[model samples]
Target: MGITHRGTTRRVRAALSAAVVICAVTAAVPAAATAAANATDAVRGPTVAVGGLDVGVERISVATDEGYGAASITPDGRSVVFRSLKDVAGSGGNEVYVHDRSAGRTRTEPIVEGWTPAISGDGRQVAATTPAQGMSTQRIRQHSLDLGILPFGCGRCNEPSLSADGRHLAFGVVDYISHNRRVLVADRDGGYQTIAYLGSGAPARPSISGDGRHVAYQDRAYQKEGVYLWDRTTGTTSGPLEGPDTYASLVQLSDDGGKVVYLSGSDTYVHDVASGTTQRVPDVKGVAIDPTGRHLLYAPHGTGGPSLVLRDLRTGTDKTVSDQPATAEVDSVSADGRDVVFQSAADGIVPGDTNGKPDVFVRRLF
Candidate 1:
């Protein structure tokens, strides 16, 4: 899944890892290229750079002159849902697209008026947030790739996330008047409950487990500011989980919800729910976690340049996946940590990437 900030609907141009990373890439420059917005054509762009390496690199997004875009990959790693400014048939702004790697086709979502897309494990369902027209609140909508829209009544909510089974949805809500924010998990049956509430500040970026039993969100209330995990079965909330500083936010949650990767004071840490153990991932900006929660795709400064690295949580081994001259943003990783989707402006990542714009690329490291 793609990591999106709380209260933010659009992908920010600045790299999120820059705050703590030394080799984080600079903001990508925009370039304009016109492609059919609703085209279901097979996605075939530049091929992998000529190397005997056993990895494959493919570009998914067309080189467009639009601003920064974002992408998320499903657990099965066969589908990717992303937001882009590519010109659509009638729409003129941001559009959501689903790229099916197995079918080799990309299609626009039914509702194009959305951002910050979250995909289910099976790649069958997606949840996105759209501004409530004429209202001060936001609305969260769920859509099925085959069917049209699913019934989701997330009024006044943003930063929507989905469980692996697509049976549950989690989001953040802010009470503008009282300055209180809460995280809620809603089931497909329309029942929802508040998992965490903050008297002040927003509890952003709620990540739910595959079973919808655990939720990890950022809490910024009074002196307590860190990542907190809420267990539905136990009905208990765990730790402010002291970070390097008083500020911390969720990065990713494992499928079982036993592990959570978070950021604090420019550093990243993974907290184990069962063992109550915290492991600090030094000098690396965390991105997404694989289904097993044992591998992390992160960005680390390397001697070659800024590159994306997949780290083993158990052995502390690191593999540089996106080894390029320019830095790349780690978007989403596959369940087995073999396929990684990221965005970069650096040329030569693939041939004919001369658009001088940021394009989404997937690196299969199997």
Candidate 2:
């Protein structure tokens, strides 16, 4: 494994530009103390360790002209699903692929011919947007990427997300009519369940928790766009993540769906579903929550350039994973927060990483 050091300092100032709002409690979460007015403006920079944290770096895909990106590592850390462009001459498209670590470097296997691929925690099931076969024009269709897929209205679906157990899948649907957009979740064997319907606003991305009982999604059906949690047992949707005039974009949820991390304007917050308190995470971009809900992996934004960051929710300690300061766009992370996968064009993170092209790299924190 290669280890490098970044010499940049972390900086965060109070007074963010986004509108601030009080946290709202809903459903099971009890109301905690509210943040004082302008308190959201009083954010502090993340604490950084000297010399950065040493991490093991490994290249998962072999270099190719067809391109391999948008990768997702299983929670158990044994398998990864990624997007691969086809190298067929005169073709200008891509598909989703699965790479089994046990298979060595035998090249990734194409699981489905689609875009935006997501896999179940065990890596046994995959979901994606495949081109509808036999359609008059090129259209997108949702599928298990294997067999037993059903049809939906308007003939379109994308941004598919799977549950930890691989039993449930949540995705967005775009209908041909107005305000008819919807967010739906379906079981691999069961039919589709309409969780939230948007009559006025467009449908946002939908995600299911590890247990497949709760779903977090953006709802435009409300007067204002808000992040909402749909309860499966009651078949009702409630508990919109409250935020400033700046609508909160829920990015990640804890394994049990008891916590949520979202971005309000440029500021990010972590909301505890059990306590209903929102904790502001200063200067963190593209935030993600670990399955334990005790750790967070994020991209730190600053003039020092983008660095892979890990923040301990319990201890408040921040560790830098990449010593080399380069522009890194975070792609996806594992459930434990130990496996962080990101795209970077920098040369210092690992030696011989001279691929020059935007390549995908995984940093194993453990």
Candidate 3:
């Protein structure tokens, strides 16, 4: 799913009115060509290099399968886990599957109808969300890759993320009656605890820094929706960086927690916490930053076809790897920061036909 921008409706209205007058004649051009050209020009800003990066689709996998969902890569970039309803055991719901890049093999494991898989920085633990069966509370389970059992659970938890040290885990949970979401934290051993709560509003996606010292999450408070960062050491929340009225989604703290990357107003921005500076990477959506914080991969929005692009932070150069339109957007990035994976469909959604099913695809960065 795409990131939702609160108060973006008004911004869209304003942009549309301005764009119609500015690009009125150019509107007849194809979106791909326009985007490619505009992106090339926009990337020349001082924060990014003008043109020195390369992007290409390394390989394509899983061409046929329906309902392939969330995915995460291990720290070493040698393996990936994703949710799929392939039902090797004939079960109807989704399960987690692991793809070993080194062995050139794929295996499935029943993680109980889970999605949004997150692997520990050391690649020892996997955290995922498992919906409750039939009116029960949902759960966030931390399963040891070696032990093969859930060692902990967080009720009503979803969108699980892990810190680089694997000591702390963050996820979003809602009140049973009020439906307001609050971010929760717990130890890897299964001790349930509340770290930060946002009352009367929904807080869905939560991401922890690679250093385990900072956390960023989406929250709707007052009459506004925004993304906030919390300092674990200071116990204070940073003011909304995307502005109080604008909603920022897919908030990610860099490996060192020094920078934040988020989708705001249909583009990705990198905010430096220490410098209090922001740099926008124009004409891109659905961004993923590498662990080293030197590279960014994003997909362009509103294109009829799927495409993946990458940008080098040191030098603002960008490139598109694939020409075919992607059915789904890029979801999770690998720990080594070399691979980008997402789900794609063969054909548009058709009833009763599973041939155009959504399958997982991974692209290695070269």
Candidate 4:
């Protein structure tokens, strides 16, 4: 269900302007305990080998102050933006912040008191959800660092994805009465149009192809939700992937528009648009194919908790890039797909419960 309510307002503080100090402490494990925990995790399941590479783990970033919420990266993989709450125990209102790797600096801006920020494919625009004053008036707002705020009207819009050209946007909009959500598309200039409706059922996440002619989304109107594709040029939709289980999430299109990747239940699968063939790429809860279309990075599901997993699609090789137990959920990948950033908890340095306070973390793909 969508978050549909209004309440008190809260302020967000900025991260320290001083240099980022990386301590030697282990994020997921202490040095002495690493060997024993690694052995246990390995025995939980057979280690699948892809491209002669075994999974390795490391910690990239950890939250120190206010909790970070949703995070997104720029196309070039040099910048990241996320939401942060001021007081860990207060109402937890959110504000957007950006981290620039090239400049080695972090900046905070009050974009909106919202969550689920989606950076445009061109890295110029951002679409996010904001709670309305009333229960039935939630809206989605688009912001551009260069152009300021763009006027657009939307109710209960969330999980937004932008096309490669940055001319169009796709998002899930909930219909209040029916309690059903549909995938909708709109021009960057604010022209609203329906893309696909799932009747009484909620439409799954929607992603647009590189050329902006096709869109891939999940639908559950028939039975359980399954990945589906829509040809924008032809104005037709098709799918109901051949599988027993029928739940899917995190739909994403390849940079070249040749393939679609989605989470089918707990496993990640890729489908060839032309051949209609499906294959698995080691199960991961979050998956993204780089803009070059050569590598795939994901957060593999595990009883040891979530960890970032990188896979080379061509070589069929995968590795665990983050050693820390995955703290925050990954939101989006850069257009070039070299870096993955997420929202995590700030525990030790921040003087608050890590689980209650969130922060942003990022890792560069090697």
Against the true structure, what is each candidate's TM-score?
Answer: 0.80, 0.74, 0.73, 0.71
Best by lDDT: 1
The residue pairs in collision within model 4 are: 50-317, 57-323, 58-322, 58-323, 67-358, 68-358, 68-359
Instruction: Please give the distance, in angstroms, between residue 352's alpha carbon in candidate 3 and its true position after superposition.
Output: 23
lDDT of 3 by residue, 178-285 (tens): 878877665544343455566654645777887777777766676445666766666566656563336666557766677678777767887777777777887677
lDDT of each model, Cα atoms only?
Answer: 0.66, 0.57, 0.57, 0.55
Clashes counted in candidate 4 amount to: 7
- Candidate 4, poorest ten consecutive residues by summed lDDT: 36-45
RMSD of each: 10.5, 15.8, 15.4, 14.1
TM-score preference between candidates 2 and 4, better one: 2
lDDT of 4 by residue, 1-366 (tens): 110112111222212221211111111223342221112110111233446632221122223444555666656776566666653233234555555555454444435645567665555455666665566455666654434455555557766666655677777878888888877666644354576667654546677765666667777665635666666665666665534365666457765666777776667777676766666765565456665555666776666743666677768777554555443332355555456665444343222334555545555444
**What is the lDDT, from 0 to 100, of the residue 279 in candidate 3?**
78
Greater-TM-score candidate between 1 and 4: 1
For candidate 1, the lDDT comes to: 0.66
Query: Candidate 1 or 3, higher lDDT?
Result: 1
Model 2 over residues 72-154: C-alpha lDDT tens digits? Answer: 67676666666655443333345555555544432233334445577676665556665554432123333332232334333
Span of ten consecutive residues with least summed lDDT in model 1: 17-26
TM-score of 3: 0.73
Off by over 4 Å in 2: 1-55, 64-66, 85-92, 105-115, 133-154, 200-203, 323-331
lDDT for residue 283 in candidate 2, whole number 0-100: 64
